[model samples]
Target: MVDDLALARHLADLADAITASRFRSRDLAVDRKPDRTPVTDADLAVEDAVRAALAEHRPGDEIAGEERGGQVGAGRTWVLDPIDGTKNFLRGVPAWATLLALVEDGSPVVGMISAPALGRRWEAASGRGAQAGPPGSPEPISVSGVGELADAYVSTTHLGTWVEHHSRESYLRLVDACWENRAFGDFWQHCLVAEGAIDLAAEPIVNPWDVAAVQVIVQEAGGTFTDLSGERTFQGGSALSSNTRLHDGALALLRR
Candidate 1:
């Protein structure tokens, strides 16, 4: 069997090279998708680089990316979100990252997230524990032990978007229930939860590319990742990642 986790991390390295180079370029080009979300040249370039690498390294494997879509195959499908926080990258906020996940038999068995701007990267393989640290030296990571919602630290992307998605009431309830809340947004929040720095990270809306890699990382880090309805699939259009202790209570409030 191929070392899928190593391959995933290699892809992340390739993506970081492209993204870090153009991160704040004066001439970086930007466009808007039909959904009105922003996409930048860096995003397209990063995805193209990752796809090309996969084509050469694992040509038979299927691939799916945010910029260009492809079907998930039965054997292996590489999922890519070249830039998970495009808005942050566009604004030079240093909050963006490249996300790559290798899905085997419809489940992500290897996952890697590289945030060059933040000088951080995280990776996990099914059976191997999750890890995070500076790009070079990584240490094992796990979820926090916060057992109650009242003591948990919660995070989300945007309150306005959450409200617009018809989840405002429940989201507000979650925020109110938590001891602290921040709009830490995107992959960073979920990664934080995986690192035990936070207790929960959720979004009222998300795509498969947005959460596939993150789901594996969190799960491998001793947390639970699910939709508001408690289903553990990335296609649910929303995400709720938490240290296992707080997942049910948080999901219950979100469902209300």
Candidate 2:
């Protein structure tokens, strides 16, 4: 039987093949979901392909995906966000990626994120730690040691999301407290926190599939992952990833 992290990596590879091919294609099919979010043929294609593989390899496991949805119930569930930055893909930007996480009994134990266009991927298991970069020679990765917000670099998915889901003023407070900040939207920003490139990443709103993998990678990198309210669960509908030392300070500034 394939190991859980290995299966997650295989799913990422399967997703990368589909996303990389259709990424900037002029004929890619794009549709709007009920929430007015864009969904591409690539998104559906990747999730369906992944579900098929999970069915064959881990049939008893539950599956939850952005496109074809299921619940992350008791026991093991494979969580997927086929294309985490669909808007970027639509705009021909190379920041898009496929995110996969293995949530066992509601907690993420393994994560695999593949951004083939960026020529990078990140993976982490509960006890294995985090690694990212080239396909074959990836090295260990961890969060920065920056302890103070004044010396830290921060990132967020979108400024508009803060206004809609949380307090924009709260986010601005964090940006103002940090040394530098960027709108490094989506999965990439959180991965940046995991790699020590950035100290914190905050998102005002997110779904389970959006952050299950992020939660795993960030924690494995020796950072902290939590909702804005400071609870460490991916289901919080919001997220904050930070180097361990700076999390509480970042959270204090983002309090509603």
Candidate 3:
């Protein structure tokens, strides 16, 4: 399991190399919500590199990536997001990341998130507790002890879907409940939860690749992860991560 975590982190490094080198290299020609070609190329390239690394080390393990889809192999599988925040990447923003996870049976046992542009990386195994830091200096980290909802700082990447699927009024209720709210979307918001910098992060829409690595990091950091309804599964497609203390309170406001 520890080996899987290490491999995932190493693969994240490989992904960072491919992505960081190409982040701002694209021409800023916003023809229509940013050209997809550059990010698509980078995505495929990173997925390919990860697949190749998996093939070499965990030869029998299956692979699933956002860009390349899936290829079954051994009992243990890896789910990857070559780039989690593609829009941000294409926009010359640093909110993107390389998300990697080892799913044993059906759950992620080892997860890693690398955002080279932000100079941050977080990695964890099922039992090993989470760790986060700059590119080099790793350290143990955990969620904050903010127990009151009114005093909690909260964030999310987007509000369109939340306002669309749920009610804008409900979304506003959540914002009103927190002391602070930020739209610091993508892996960074979740990382902030893991580092205890924020009390909660709620996203209206996401995917396994979007939240898998983050889920592991949050849980291992003494926090909790769940759908807006508080169900613990990436399949929910939306998440509400918190420092555990304020999770249910946030859930209550959202559910109301």
Best by lDDT: 2
TM-score of each: 0.97, 0.98, 0.91
Among the numbered candidates, top TM-score falls to 2
Q: Candidate 2 regions off by >4 Å?
A: none
Worst 10 residues of 2 by lDDT: 130-139
Instruction: Put down candidate 3 lDDT per residue, 1-256, tens digits, no spaces.
Output: 4477677777988999999888887543322323243445678789999999888998878888876778434478888989888888877888888999887766677889998998989988898999988866789999999999889899875668787766676689889988899888888888899999999998887877778788888999999999887898765878889999988778888884
Output the TM-score of candidate 3: 0.91
Which tens-of-lDDT digit does each residue in 1-256 have in candidate 2?
A: 8899888778888998899899889899999999999999999999999999999999999998999989999999989999999999999999989999999888999999999999999999999999999776679999999988999999986778889899989988999999999988899999999999999999999999999999999999999999999999999999999999999998899998
Clashing pairs in 3: 60-74, 157-185
Clash counts for the predictions, in order? 0, 0, 2
lDDT of 3: 0.83
Winner on TM-score between 1 and 3 is 1
lDDT of 1 by residue, 46-115 (tens): 8898899899889889998989998666899999999999999999999989999998878888889999
From the highest lDDT down, the ranking of the candidates is: 2, 1, 3
Model 3 scores worst on lDDT over the 10 consecutive residues at: 28-37
